[model samples]
Target: MIQKYPVGIQDFEKLRSENFLYVDKTEFIYKMADIGGYYFLSRPRRFGKSLFISTLECLFLAKKELFKGLYIEDKWNWEQSNPIIRMSFSNIGHKYLGLKDAIDKRLDEIAEEYNLSLVAPSIDQKFKELIQKLSAKRGKVVVLIDEYDKPIIDYLGENPDKAIENRDIMKVFYSILKDADPHLKLVFITGVSKFSRVSIFSDLNNLDDITIDSRFAGCCGITEEELADNFVEELKTLDKQEIKRWYNGYTWDSSTSVYNPFSLLNFFRKKTFQNYWFETGTPTFLIKLAEKTQLYDFSEVEIGANALAAYDIQKLELIPLMFQTGYLTIKSYSPMSDVYILGYPNNEVKKSYIEVLMAAYSQSDLGYGVVYVDKIRQLLEKGEIERLEGILNTIFKSLPYELWQKENEHFYHAIIHLTFSLLGVYIQSEVQTSDGRMDALIRLKDFVYCIEFKLDESAEKAIQQIKDKGYLVPFSAENKKLVAIGINFSREKKKVEEVKWEVIKA
Candidate 1:
């Protein structure tokens, strides 16, 4: 039978029954058996973390029928099936009049599943009792908690101290698992972001974070190999150019590139590609993240080397934000460093972020997303550079500099690059080439534009710098015209002061 894409469908049983196209990561089940007993994996929202955990639940419950034709069918022993207990906290309350009491209510539901009650006063006691009772009832309990950090993540900055208290409560409850291990077959947990070090997940000391474990990296999301092999028919019906520009690019591992399961499946299902992930609603926490912590330099800010496993999520670090929101992905692994080089995950996540950044920079004028790209493309193909400059000027004029003032000179330039870069436009900040380095490189179709920006410096000086550096030498062999532009910024108005342009014929 033919398979269709499983766009938003994550329920394992539901997908199997409905015949939603399923990529068999079931091989991972056997792969994981050899790894640690307790594991934690963090991925962006809608990246299929829930589905992975659901598959795990099925495996432990010894659902042999489900694995009959999958990758793990021949690899597993179908003789033993353990008792399964699954809990998802993605729907936890974001706003609570009482906070602590709201957490109690949420945990209470998990308690009911085991017919366990907390005769003890605190929520932690309720959680501990629930786990202990479940462990006793079955020969071995397989506990799968999806979005384990959701309780506190929902209240992160709203009432930070309250968030801390909720974390403390979870830490206490999870700590019980160490003793419950005697009766626990396996335990798995997942979330959008990891806990902010200390006092969180304090109980699960044996928790093995496989977020960067190279062996299972392809478990949650779909790799490009899987896409090309599985979705060849679907691609034949779509606009190939539009599809690549929107859904391609997340370089997870150099050897295995991945398409966002969320966006890829949706694009085929609807025969369209819009902001499928954002449709769930922007994580307001992202806005609060920048505002609470003065992280004004996300764009052009370089993180030289880092490990996804060791990256700190505490008190707002760039790596976590980039990872949590789906900007940076695991690119390469170094067993010695135990680290991963994180970079843009896919075209959709990167492109959609401009909409978020615009709102952060200027709450007022972010209304005009540079998405008017096709319109820009239309004009460019029609040779409307003069009109293009006018429109560019108008867009800059509308920018609220005051909104980005905190970022200083760096913000000014980063925002400029970010603005154009977000529109699927190719922008290079401080690029280096054989003909000497350029402050910026803007590519539109076959044409290449070299640009230099100056503040309190003459536009002529900036223009001369471009010429002196021989920035135009490299474009000599191109079929399209090359343009060199010098931009002057006003220390006075704090916006694009003036632009000097020199267009060269091919």
Candidate 2:
């Protein structure tokens, strides 16, 4: 019998009771509970953070029957149950009611559930009162707050003032966790973004942020080992490597990578490779920010450990935002300098993200962008350089006239970069050689194209630059056919004015 995959089911009791197949993550829960403390984990949305929090709630509530054959079954002391104040900011009706009022109402519900009354008026005071009363009545209370940043993240881009207001309210609301530590057994908070400690978590100094901790990297998502172990029958019909290529590259510590559970499960259900997770929500703000910063290429983005540590709303850095929100992930790390190399996690993210960026930059619909990208891919595969150039010119021609500026050179390069990047082809932009830097290099199965882009300059000059810089030197001895192409965008025409290419011979 095939096991039922728990897709979109966040409730642990419902999942287990309904006989849903669970990738056992109880060992991580045991590790955390055995060393009980206030912990905060930041993972991308739809990566099973909510389900993990629900499992934690069940574990703390001493639901031993739910863990009959799981890892934590015999490990946990099921008799020592604690009052669980489980709150998910995503479902708290914060959009209709204000953040503070929504939280206040949730606190009231929790108090009522425990058969306790709270005279505290403020949100923080009410939180503290609930914890103290719960600890006094039952044992110590366990607090599980899921999507803790939703109240703020939802308002971001749409309303900065409201986002800031919600952040401040959360600052005061979460401040109680620190003071009420005596009454709390465990406080586990999960969110998509990690606001700087100076912002939302200023008062909660003791909270251990294990967002990038290697030990718990596999706590939330489905790891390679876990995927193999759980999806035995499911793997029989699936292309394992293709699946990995599409979904399995997200890493926190650059040591243990995991598949985006939302996408992975959806893939099994649909039996097709699609952007299941990315389609759930578009990163409109991120795309706009990338365009503002001209950050189309993410192949070799490097940042210090401090950069990924935290970022406040006032100083919204693009790289950190992309990293935290699941667009970019740690590809490599250098301990000597404590620096991280970030890139797109997988084909799903790279293709989907670039498609969105292409649509936004080109001022066209996503379908048009995708069709152009597909055409470009086909041309490259067939070595149809002339047709490829025509498509490139057409892409630029479609751009709105009003959006062009004198310094719109980067805009042209960005569109081209996003176009090639979307093809899931091996590509490098701004490639540095011994002599000079080359604008772009695309490596296909049968052809290696040395490409350079010039603005208000002759295509011959761009081609000569590639030759002078010895850009093709690296691929000189490769088995594939080599070709050099130069493209020039005219400032007056605001489109590709010249396209030149040469078939390199050894």
Candidate 3:
């Protein structure tokens, strides 16, 4: 029997009634409703935020018939139901019409649903009045907002001014939640980023942010166990490890990571390995932000707990935004210092991101990058030193003039880092070897290359430093061949000026 996979259908009642495959996340929903009064969750786009919100809608409405065999069926009270006020910002109207107009239109729709009229002059007042009126008759109102930051996120890159304006409108609109707290049973808001308090959540500061909260870490996305238990038939012919490598490393905390539900479902439907999650949309603004900030050290990017929670359009930080937006994820956590080390979540992201970055920064064709990666891999495997050097020179020489003019060392390092990474080889950036930290370490099946990159310095010095530092001492015993490569870039030319290499054994 072919199971119906809910690809774009977020309506929980329809999904359940139509016999679609639903990974039961109601247990978490039950715990959250029973435990909290107000909550905020941050996850990437298409990571099941909409579906989660829809589930909460059904749950709050006490639609017990839809959840007959689910985990929450026995645990929840079927007799008790609250009037649900659901709003999603994904389809909010024309940007030129402004956010206030969109809010008014949405409020009018809601008012019609309740068979009432709202005469409030502003969005905030309309929201407040609706909450009071609904809860007055229904006992208490349940509020669930999906894609709460869509209006602002959509305008972040092109119209930053509008983004800020929309944020102000949203701040005013969401502020009504706090005022209507007395009549609200549960308030749940979900978005892509945790916009800082002063910007978006100032009035709603009491809301508990369960983004990194360990208890609800598995709430939004499909967990490894959930996938195994629910989709056993889908796994019989699939490479489980490939699926894990492609979509299984999005982490909220340091543990209990989950797969992107959109990608996993598509993988089953399509029966192929591709970047389904990224293909939905890659924010050009975020990539441009990284390039503008010269954030090339993709490996050791770290953020404090406070910084990670900070998201203001006026003063946005690259590390936190990348981590929150799903381009990068929590690699590790330091309990003592309250910091998170963030990196590309999985192979799918790393590859897609590099292609995006290269295209954005260098205007290089993604297909060309893939071809160059294959050529470079073959060159390294055959120990073609001079040809490999020429390839590196060509890669740098082809960089766009605007990017070349920046002349930032970090930018150049990013180019090199991405080059080796695309080849699917073992690449350790800034590897701490026996004596000193090596710039990069690349390992293929038959060869190990110690790479040292220098600016405004001789290539000979780079190789000597690698040798002096005993960067290859740890690999001396390995039977595979070893090579030390030194690459030097000239700031004036904005390209590789010299290349030196020493093969230890073959």
Q: Show pairs that collide, candidate 1.
A: 175-203, 250-345, 250-346
lDDT of 1 by residue, 248-350 (tens): 5554444555667788778787776677865576666676565455453343333334423333334656566666557666556565665555555545666
Each model's number of backbone clashes?
Answer: 3, 0, 0
lDDT tens per residue, model 2, 195-266: 655678888888899999888999988999999999999899889988998899999989998999999999
Stretches of candidate 2 above 4 Å error?
405-407, 425-439, 464-479
**Candidate 1, which segments miss by more than 4 Å at Cα?**
1-3, 34-36, 92-136, 239-245, 251-255, 291-301, 304-314, 330-341, 371-389, 400-411, 426-439, 493-495, 503-506
Off by over 4 Å in 3: 94-96, 401-411, 424-436, 476-478, 490-498
Better-scoring candidate (lDDT), 1 or 2? 2
Flag the better candidate by TM-score, 1 or 3: 3
For all predicted structures, in order, the TM-scores are 0.85, 0.93, 0.92
TM-score for candidate 2, please give it. 0.93
Best model number under TM-score: 2
